[model samples]
Target: MLTEEMMTTTEMILMTYLFEIDEWLKDKKVIQQQQAQLTKEELVTVIKNDLTTFQANQATDYEKKLQTTLTTLEALSEAQFQKMKLEILSWGPNVKHVD
Candidate 1:
């Protein structure tokens, strides 16, 4: 039951998510390159920290955002679209405002 507007917004969200995933994967490559230039223990520690962050929070956060966006998009109407748009827009400012 998604309206045209809703579908457009949802598509935008999915595209943004894909872009973020791509950037993070790129970051992984950069980290790998950095690791290659480091001594063994330093490389191991950096990688371990990155993996822990990925497992404990970053990946889970993105997955949740994507799932929620998809689930909500499936049942969207015009009013719902506007509301969701506001919520999505707010996320950025709220994040920036956080310490």
Candidate 2:
């Protein structure tokens, strides 16, 4: 994901896959928002099963996504990680990086 260098064909394809993953992550968040319809007026027990299912699914999905992200990062050499040091440091704690 170097900004300065032109990506190789494989890198371009991988980038597309990463972008797709990012989009799916965003879309899943929306789905979660829709599913999490808690009301102050009334709480229902029926929602519990669905909520539990969603939580479990989301946790599993997140773990898979994290592993995929780690794979991309783990491919990078130390120099590459250094090149991305500033960007990684700039990110809040949620973003993972080698540095």
Candidate 3:
């Protein structure tokens, strides 16, 4: 029942709609890709910050442990020196009092 002019008009309308839909889809894809890239960059920054914090904490813990070990060694050395001094003193007159 459609005339030739009506068929041509309908075809033109359909083509316009299809072109608009295609353009919208392409824009959507570009926006999605940009969002994905931003998310990846944010994640990388967070991971790097976390790694830096972890390394700092590890270094602090190591220093604390090393200090504790040094303190313990110094105490043990002092106690041993005192024990040797007492042993020598207990020998009384038999031990020489060398300067």
Model 1: per-residue Cα lDDT over 1-99, one tens digit each: 545644554545433422343544454211223322443234234434444555643467544444445554445555554464444334431133231
Across 1-99, the per-residue lDDT of candidate 2 in tens digits comes to 532222232232223222344644454211223212322111122223333544553466434443344444455665553444333224332344342
C-alpha lDDT of candidate 1 relative to the true structure: 0.42
Residue 57 Cα positional deviation in candidate 1, in Å, after optimal superposition? 30
Report residue 71 deviation for candidate 1 (angstroms): 5.6
Off by over 4 Å in 2: 1-59, 91-99
Residue 83 CA error for candidate 2 (Å)? 2.0
Which residue pairs in candidate 3 have backbone atoms (N, alpha carbon, C) closer than 3 angstroms, thus clashing? none
lDDT of 3 by residue, 10-78 (tens): 233222222343544454211223222323234234434443555653466534433333233233344
- On TM-score, the candidate that comes out on top is 2
CA error at residue 74 for candidate 1, angstroms: 3.2
| CA shift of 62, model 2, Å | 1.1
Q: Candidate 2: lDDT of 19? A: 35
Pick the winner on TM-score between candidates 1 and 3: 1
Q: Considering only N, C-alpha and C atoms within 3 Å, which residue pairs clash in candidate 2?
A: none
Stretch of 10 with least lDDT, candidate 2:
35-44
Candidate 3 positional error at 13, Å: 0.6
Q: Number of clashing residue pairs in every model? A: 0, 0, 0
